[model samples]
Target: MLRALCALLGLTSAAIAAKFELSPKKFLTLPLGDIKPAGWLHDQLQVQTDGLAGHMHEFYDLVSKSDWIGGDSYYSYLEEAGSYWFNAMVPNGVLMNNSIINEKTQEFLEYVLENQDATGWLGPEVDTEKPRCLWGRYPFFFGAIQMVEYKPELTARVVDALHKFVKLANRMLRNGEGVDKWAATRWEDFVLTLQWLHDFHPRGEEELLVDTMVRLKWSGVPWEEVFSEEYFPTGPVENLTNPFGLELSWHGVNMAEGFKALPATYRFTHNQSDIDAANLSWDLMFKYHGRPSGAYAADEMLAGLEAVRGTELCLVVEAMFSGSYLYQVIGDLKYADRVERMTYNALPATLTANMWGRQYLQQQNQVAAQNMSPNPFPEDGPYSNVFGLEPNYPCCTVNFPQGWPKFITNAFLVTSDKKGLVQLYLGPFEVQTTLNEDNLVKVSVETFYPFGDNLNITITATKSYMHYIRVPSWIVGGSMTVNDGEKTGLVPDEVTGLLSVTIGKGLTKIALHYPAKIVIEERPHGSIAVHRGPLNYAFDIPRSEKIIAQDPREPHAVDLQMGPIGAWEYALDADPATMSFHNEAENDDHYKLPSPIFDSGKPSVSIAVSACSIEWPLAGDMFVTSPPENPECLGDVKTIQLVPFGATKLRISEFPVFAHSEPSLRVGNSYQIGDDSEPVQKPFNPTKPN
Candidate 1:
């Protein structure tokens, strides 16, 4: 069955592309508990489940009362705002409900029901009352997916409501004779809706699914109106239009790789044209320019290969959702792997480690995280968020929470029994399923991963059925072994880059191979980096040490080599290594910041850091953004040892890799940190002249 998943995807290289049956008692619903924020995900959604619920409610209630909803409403902003609330609140309310928060979510849901239109579309929010399909439709579709899980009967209504909304837009695009220019995008919300409807609808014909795909153009975003661009490139980057502005045309706009929709629509219907369209779209978006972050657009504009400038907060979340869905739609493990990798690194890296904060816009190569501006809104402290999230456009602020809550659902799902294909890793969640006609299986996971590196899955079965545990691509030592039978553990399948674990009935133990130490390596994109295993190791920076990250003062920058190997044995071979460090040099620039933000009047830069002595982990963004001093930086002779980026939140990430002018002559190790002596160098040469 796992092989079939990979082969099924091979049917249409172009088209990429879940849920539950309504029979037995605990069929489609997900399990819940004091779910630890495990995997690379948890940290983002924790705020919604814990602290941010109140503020979110206030924000939702505040928006619900505004002229935000109307027959001719400017819904892009409202939908974005509502989506921000629904994505976090809806799933959290259903899976990890708190009484106080539930009341707010119910109110939001009721408001939508009250405003339903006769056509079955609820989008009275557009100006001129013209119901466009894609943009505003997604947040509502996502909210409905959550609602259906909460209230089963609402499933039909949710489907009908979205069907009405999408059908209306489809009519304008395909059947409407004089509806001006219509919008039908593959990447838009409607495809997400269609994918949902196809997978879970109680009783729906395949024709509707076929119809959705039949009308789309394989061309790029249709650039007939609204979006002003000069070139219609493959990917959606800002200013990627032609000189005269007419080219690969997509859903009436440029950089709109609406191509992702066709194969997705065809996933259920198998329309080759639609599949062809989706593949073409995928080729275009990536061929032009894509980032390692899985986000290509620059500030909602499509700019290709502009390394220093790329990806928005909204794009990161949206792309993750799309990629995960595509993985499910195609039953391809690789797609799931892509989704997992991007979320683990790019998504979290986009926002602050804590969910409460985020950047309005992030530059891919803006290495220094320093803030030069004062707080725009008094209530929001300087370091609380990124630049300029004022009166509106708080997209990242509201939308960021959507990542993890939705991600938990994608973390694991049911696969076929015959094929040993556990397409995902980090599972062992409670999956209430029937093996024979009578027996049930409840799998519980217990392990402190990427940390402790051991797993114990206790599978309690009602009857007898086979379960496959996904084998990760990166196994440090050897493959996993299952107690079920001879070599029950999964071996790697070259066809589908995933390991499998197939076990039969009753309680079973599956041992997955994991390494104790994890080191992150660099990829070609030249943005932020990632580690193969769990530990996201950065250059160690000691908090108590006076060493700071960057020097914004003298245009100082740092760079490094990529794909450098040998981290595994690096620590083991350390010969009683003695290292030195210093106190984090406070930035005077930060002192110039407003109240509660200014520093303690310390210097803008520090000399060096102790490799492992990070005392103040709380001093996040503060230490790294502190600018260094001039070349006379330490006068005659000052030498300090530097640590890893992960070692200190206040330490630097973006550095001037290449030191120009031959280091301007060697400055001695006079500038000391901690209690260390002069530095020592152990050089290795393949052809050493001893």
Candidate 2:
């Protein structure tokens, strides 16, 4: 009977015999807690745990007194805010192994599971006339799915409850019950959860799961049509209400989540157009709205590449999630590159070093983080860019916690065939998983990547296996040595760009050396952004932070108004040959990363460049306008220090080019310190597909 049904659906006989049937993913994601952050990455997670992410439940009304947890204070009728917190906290708690957080997460999970409505609804909206929006369950079930993956004992109960909810959701979606404004446009999230069940725990209910996914896709916004040239916005969206009315395509958060909608749908359809549309969406998004921080400009709506324009923190984290998802499904190197870029640069730029406060919006040329009177954001409020708890909205407050935890989980992925272990993202992590169902592989990565140019990888495997590592596009020339023997130049596959190496039985050590060089990228208005590896370099402006408001229950959780105290109008010299790189961690074995590594002045790497103050003006006395084209140098040239973009709260990232000399240098060529030879200039052809 299953084979007949599979034949009817155009599925293979092998798929019919399998647990569930869906188009195979290019790579398999490890279970939530299979990989753990280590070293500086570990410290990052610990800081997150000690900050707003860990303590939100104690004081925050939306989380502490949420409707889902049997409390009265509900953020919305959809009951999404608390579920956002749950989705983030579950993974963080499990990865950090924090007992307190774990207990809270488990309590919430148990409450929702035990309180399932008799009609099969999962949330608090039991009113049949006004059926609850299915959107909220997207995040809630995401967290529940993670919990089930980590704890097998609860899988049966959770799966049963989810199956019941799925039945109701199928009926509700078919009858046009819960799919509405936000829910209709963002239905891909629900499809993702349904696909998870179909892939992992569909106990003889594959047909129902597939049917639900299809219905949800039909009810959701047509992303392929939305991304087509005829309908997509070529520039910044002006009238947010007109062209894309009712679709909410201009909204920042929706765009971020919707970016992966077609990709998710492709899993069932297996259509090439779906993948092409997703890829096209990515190219167009970054082309028009891309920021130097590896995020797009969408303060509230889809803004342009103007320096003063801000990107929402929620958009930043959501884009990271979408990027990671795209990479897992399509095995695209560009997606992985984007995820790493955002993770290293943009994710930390919006938050306070302690992770207690975060900005709702972050701008590339931000010189101040105070409330703006005439800001550039089209739909956001004046307080959008200020760093605080729930600065502009509470959604970011609950949603931002998922960024680091999910990144850690996605750092290592098993190849589709399960015969190869792939290091998808560079970070300090330890992963223990079974490859090929029997070969147990435990790989430990230790290094300060993007901060330092060395990776110390140790693979302990029960049997010989093939290991693959992604060679970042920014690398000029990297080399690897096995067992500290003769070094070989790292060569990546021409098609996939992955550096493959064979691993033997038992334990083996490998050392990778990638020379870090300064890269100059030309931005709009002839401005330039500096890069070394995945880290974007910016002029870190010293700031004076004033406390404006505080949480009465927790005085430490305060809103801050910050402004630059130092000169931030500097423009870099056009010639890259004169730039210098400094590594303070070099030759200093006693050097230790500060408790909060993203804090200003804590980064061990700095770029010294010859620059001068340019005649730049402020936009509405709030933030700097676009970099002045060929502006006159206001002062004598001086050496200025550039730190990682994540290290600064107020920064000048996109700088004007100060043309003080002749045309002897090019923009794409990289500069390495201590090399006595003249630098070779090369045309900049970015690895991003057009």
| Candidate 1 lDDT, 1-690, residue by residue in tens | 222332433433222232211111101223223122332223234444553333544443324445345444333333456655665667666545466666766776667766777765564444554544445446766776777766786766667766676666565545532121223233344555665665567255344443453333321133222222233354442334444343323221223324334445455435455434443444445445444333454444554544334355666666666656554544444445545544554555554332333454443333333332443212223332232222124555566666666666655555533222232546324344443465555666654332234566666665455555544444434445567445333355543445544456566776665532122222222222223332222332222311123223221111111111111000110111222222232222223212111111211211231121111111233222211211112122223333322122222232211112221112131111111342221111101100
Model 2 score (lDDT): 0.81
User: Each candidate: what lDDT?
Assistant: 0.41, 0.81
Q: Measured by TM-score, how close is model 1 to the native structure?
A: 0.63
CA deviation > 4 Å runs, candidate 1: 1-44, 51-54, 60-62, 65-68, 71-79, 124-134, 175-188, 202-205, 216-262, 268-297, 302-307, 363-392, 416-439, 483-490, 516-530, 534-690
Q: Model 2, 238-300: lDDT tens per residue?
A: 653435455476778888999879788778767677789898888878877787678888878
Worst 10-residue lDDT window, candidate 2: 681-690
- List ranges where model 2 is wrong by over 4 Å: 1-20, 65-78, 126-130, 240-244, 660-690
